[model samples]
Structures are given as C-alpha cells and as structure tokens.
Target: MWRSLWRSIDRFSPQYFKYILNELRGIKVVERSNRELVIDILQSMVEIVTYGDKHDPIIFEYFMEYQVMAEFVRVLKISKNSRIEAPLLQYLSIMIQNIESDHAIYYCFSNGYINSIITHPFKFEGGDLASYYMSFLRAVSSKLNRDTLCLLVKVELVS
Candidate 1:
C-alpha cells in the first residue's frame, strides 16, 4: 500500500504537493469548527512523515522544495481557536526544529517566516496553546544567532 502511494507521486511534482496543501487549507475554510476533522488532517500529515523509514527525509525535502512551510504558516496565521492551532503549532515546531538544510533555514528567516510564528503563540490567552508556543520558541532559539536575536529585540518583537 505504501509503495503504491509513493509510486503514484512524482517526487519532484509540485502539483501533488500543492494539492495536499490546498486540501489542508480548504479544510479550515470549509469545515471551520470541526476540530476532530482538523486534528485528523494534521494527524495524516504527521503519519506521512512517519510511515516510511525512520530516517526517510522525503516529506521534509518535499516541504522545502515546494515551500509548503509557508502554506502551513498561512493556515496558522488565520487559525481562530486552540483546537485547530495546537496541532498545527506542534507540526510547525517539528518542521522548524528539525530543519536540516541551510537553504531551507535561510528561507525561513529571510521570508519573514520566523516573524509570523514567533509572534503567533502570544496571541492566545490559553495555557495549552501557550505551552506549545513556548516550546516552538525554544526550538527556534536554539538555532538563533546573536544578530537575529538582536534584530528581534531591536524591533521590539520579543522581550
């Protein structure tokens, strides 16, 4: 079953990648408050990355190639509730923390990707969401440098 699924995908195909991302974004718009449905979709995303070899890097590579991380951020930006945002944040944290390529990491900071997420976690007042947000920040800071950290502080984006 996995072989068949992988076979049908063109590893370099932008269409397949975009189709999955569009479907994810569509779920937010169409199903709005369906938390179970949202979690299900998020779970499927995690499953995709976990279903293959333990060291398999195909999914993350695809994500960077298509710049799908931006799409994920877009979803998180518009997310209105913890129910939906929590899983997305968890997924984002994984994506942000394990970024293995310099180019991908560069794009993250260069494209204002870090800014979007760095500020997201503070928007909510709930503890469940804040903890994940804090974790995400911790993951990001581990990779942050002096200049980037200074810039963030200079802009008053972080305390």
Candidate 2:
C-alpha cells in the first residue's frame, strides 16, 4: 500500500511540481483580500512539507533552491497586518519544526530568517496573533541546544 502510494506520488513529475510551486510563489498575499486564496497557498505549502521525511532532503532542497522561505519573509517584511502575517508565520513555524537537516536548520537560524518570524516587531491587536508567535517560540526553544540557546536568548530578549 505504501509503495502504491509512493508510486502515485511519483507520477507528479518534477516539472509539474515546479509549475505548481511557481504559481504558488506568484501569489501576492499582502495585496490580496481573498482569504480563501491565502489559506489555499499556505495549506499547499503545509502539504508539501508534510510529505517529506526527516531523512529525505529532496523536499528541503527544493524549498531552498526555490527560495520559498524568502517569499514568506518578503510577505512579513512588506505587510504590517497580522491577518496576513499570521499564516505566513505559521508556515514558517511548521518549516522550522519539520526540518530534518541540521544544515537547513542552521541556515534558517543563523541567517536571521527564523529570527524575523519570531520577533516580528509588529503589534497584534487581540492577543490572538501573539499566541501563535509564542507557540512557535516554544517549539524552537524546546529544540534548542547550547549553541542555539544563546541565539534564542538574544532573539527572545530583543523580541
């Protein structure tokens, strides 16, 4: 059954995945008022990352090569609205949590990409959005080691 599922998944050619990813990348989340589209995009991203295994680097490589994280960061940078930022942040949080490779995780943390998501500098109105950020922080803190603890401390203090 698992092999059959894998075979079914394999039928999605690399070109097809690229086309879908390109379309997803093209979405302007900050400018669009369509809430459904935002959900769809984020959900699609979640599904992609979900399919990956902890030892599998293929999906992770594709994400890095395609610069999907950059797009999420771009949305956060250009938009002050939490409604827009929350989903993007959640997408990033999932990425942080599910990432299997130390190299990928290190790049995200060291380069300040994950920091930006954590310390968003934007105010959330109802405390709802703040909770989401807090959840992400907790997950990250739990996963921290001695080296990353220092960086996490600095980021938490600054945030």
Candidate 3:
C-alpha cells in the first residue's frame, strides 16, 4: 500500500505535486481538530521527507532553510492533542533540534548520493538503499545525546 502511494508520488507532475503539498499544508493547519487526518498527513509528510527528494539543490536548500521544519512544527502543535497516538511529533521535534547541529549538515553532504536516490529514486540503478538511509540516520544518531535518542524512539512508540 505504502509502496504504491510512493510510486504514485514519484510519477506525479510538478503541478500535481504542488497541489498535494498545498492540500497537506492545509490539513496540517487544521490537524488539531482532526486527529485521524493529521496522522495520515504526518505519515505522508514523513514519506516525502524521507524518500521524496534528496538530490535536488532546491529541495536541499529548502530543507537547509528549515521551512520544512517550520511546517512540521505547525503539524506538531496541532497534533499535540493526539501525542499519545502520534510518535511522529517527537521524531520531528528531534529532527528540528538536530538540524541545527553539525551532524545534520555533515550527513547532508556526505549522504548526497543516497539523498539523490530519495529525490529521484527512478535514477537509482541499484544499491542497498535501506542500509544507506539507516547508516545516514546512525551517523546523525552518533552526534546526539543518549537522552535525545531515547526520546526520539519513545515518540515513535507512544502512539
């Protein structure tokens, strides 16, 4: 199910992609009043953030500027009421905090090739992509304190 959704996203036209983003943005804004919808939106956002775009300089620049983080924060605030069932809020919080740290920028550059796959998976010939992303996360993890790491996982399991 998830794979199909991702594949559809992969094939989306730029206008369609923008439309999806805009709709998600609106849903994110009203998420506080709609827990179930928020959960779906967050899951979609995670897919996009994790697998949607990694190579485009524009996406990289947008991430660097933290606009994505800001939008995530908006969703976090709305979803706080559903925190018991929403571990993503915690994951996102940690991501925002760590983005300011050196590890994020380092990983960003070092993982450029993998990032490229995320942005344009159609271009990926073949590789252990899971390990690549995992290693990138591990590299980021090494830079964080144990407490923060625990908090991130706890967020994942909370709901």
Q: Pick the candidate with the highest lDDT.
A: 2
Q: Assess the local accuracy of residue 27 in candidate 3 as a C-alpha lDDT between 0 and 100.
A: 66
How big is the positional error of residue 76 in model 1, measured in Å on the Cα after superposition? 1.8
Model 2 per-residue lDDT tens digits across residues 38-68 = 6566666655654543544576567667776
User: What TM-score fits each model?
Assistant: 0.62, 0.70, 0.41
> Could you tell me how far off, in angstroms, the CA of residue 10 lies in candidate 2 after the best superposition?
6.5
State candidate 2's TM-score: 0.70
lDDT of each: 0.60, 0.63, 0.44
Q: By lDDT, highest first, what's the ranking?
A: 2, 1, 3
The C-alpha stretches of model 1 lying farther than 4 A from their native spots are 1-18, 28-32, 43-62, 121-123, 146-159
TM-score winner between 1 and 2, please give it.
2
Ranking by TM-score: 2, 1, 3
What residue runs in model 2 are displaced by over 4 Å at the alpha carbon?
A: 1-17, 53-56, 80-82, 147-159
Q: Model 1 compared with the native: what TM-score? A: 0.62
What lDDT would candidate 1 get against the real structure? 0.60
What lDDT tens digits, residue by residue, belong to model 3 across residues 81-152? Answer: 343122443444334334543434444434232233224322123444444444545645555565444433
* Backbone clashes counted, model 2: 0
Name the lDDT value of residue 67 in candidate 1: 67
By summed lDDT, which 10 consecutive residues of candidate 1 come out lowest? 47-56
